[model samples]
Target: MDDSEADDPNRTSPRPAASGGWSRLSASRGFLLLWGAQSVSTLGASSASFVLTLEVFRDTGSAVALAVLTVMSSAGNIYLAPLAGAFADRIGHRRAAILANVVLATASAVMATVSLIGPGRLLGLVYPLVLVSAIAASMLTLTLTASIRRMRQDADLTRINGVTTLLQRAPVIVAPVVGAALYATVAPAYVYVVDGLTSLGCVAALLVVRWDAPPLAGPRRANPFPGARDGLAWILRHRGIREMQIGFAGLNLFNGLGVTATTAYVILLADRRWGSASGLAAYNVSAAVGLVAGAALAG
Candidate 1:
């Protein structure tokens, strides 16, 4: 391929000769940096999520409050994913990823500040901040997923995806344990500070990694709704994909309910019995382990 074509971000490179193991992925400096940044950020975010849920449940002693917070967080991803994806496509994936991380870092910092001033009075602020962070995080995830295709050959896509999936899930397995330890030893403000620092670290990694400019997709649309609508229509038109999505929606609904109920039950049980965050961490770790095992088996 010519230098121009090689430099086009929207163009997928021709597949190279078959390779074994992670040789192809490990050889790509860009993918390595991207992978490291994403893995670290996931770890930080997962740990912070554990801490936040525990704190919220402990503070309010109400399962409803915890459920509300969880709902608000998921709502951002569910409702705004299409819009976020469209926006990221317009801005360039690398730039969008950087912007999203910046927003996430800022939200974490603000939460930390609120915790320091007075956690009891400021607890209400956490809900809005969580919503904002969730939006940014969804955008970040969308951009990174798009970037992965551009970073490797078509033949290596499956392997690269498997590696990414495993690394992402691997963090969760240990994040709760680390989070519980942090919660037991430090103030909540410090936990937020750590989360913010990890986000900044991701931003720095994104900056250092070289990225090709995405090709222009003609004139930019003033409204993203058209693109989102078109995308949804395309999905609906595909019988297999449409059915799969319907199945997933039902599965996720029940899974969400089960997870929420189980989390509340375990936390409450631990509070009454063991009286520590360790119980929550134990539950999370076990669930995460199962998820990782499933991913490995699937891969």
Candidate 2:
């Protein structure tokens, strides 16, 4: 997804299970299903992103508005961040992951459905519906991510984390190419339908999973929201996480400007070299493949 790793850089950061008995790579049957669900949902996520960005420009023809998608997503992340971490830590990870997946699937479906109906953008419904759904999807996405992060035990941390990131991102690389081709071949509307179908696939994966997920213990239970400071309090205490926040703050600015600039850039460079939607999709896929390979090697 274009928004890949945007919410929490640590979302894919290593988080091997802090405690467990097995030296094996897996946690349980349920967790396995959960992981599979995440991978599939994420596939649709990137595919939708490619098609959606194309749709935005195709409809509005504004690099500026297309760039604003980052701002809209950031707003969602800000609103969700407070509760996201605490919810992951407090509620059973399995529960949080399942509920979040459901929420995201619903949101994805709404956005896709609105696009499919063809309101002509005269009513101005498509943009708002997609934005709202994006907000909800992001919130739930964080919880699901945390659950995946927490499932594996200590020894497998780096490898599992890398695999998860790869799983989350592999689609980002491949789906867009498929999406661009799909767009060239069919109406743009089908992309959203595919997205909706993938979300359901994620639900199916979730259903198949069978983790005996437990809740976080004592000090970790400190709820920091709804006036409870315990959860928010600890994150603030960590210099590293705080720095992560700062880095992302800067990234949003860079990314916002960069997306628009890329539009201009491709336009400028097209005389000598061209990066059409399909071309861009190919580039992204190659880069993500490189990153996935790197992560695998590093681990």
* Candidate that would win on TM-score: 1
Best by lDDT: 1
| lDDT (Cα) of model 2 | 0.61
Candidate 2 per-residue lDDT, tens place, 174-235, comes to 78678778867886667667676766776676555434445665575344465546656776
10 residues in a row with least lDDT, candidate 2 = 5-14
Residues 1-299, candidate 1, lDDT per residue (tens digit)? Answer: 24754565533332323553343444376677777878888888888889888877767777777777788899777687778877888877777888999999999899888777754466679888888888898998887777777667787789988888877778888899889999889998888888899899888877666455463478987786776688889999999999999999999988888888888999888977765588999999998888777866996
lDDT of each: 0.79, 0.61
Candidate 2 Cα errors over 4 Å, as ranges? 1-30, 87-92, 117-124, 127-131, 148-150, 214-251, 264-276, 286-299
Clash list (residue pairs), candidate 1: none
Residue 168 local lDDT, model 1: 73
TM agreement with the true structure for every prediction: 0.82, 0.68
Clashes (candidate 2):
5
**lDDT against true structure, model 1:** 0.79
Candidate 1 residues lying further than 4 Å off, grouped into runs, are 1-27, 117-120, 213-216, 222-251, 295-299
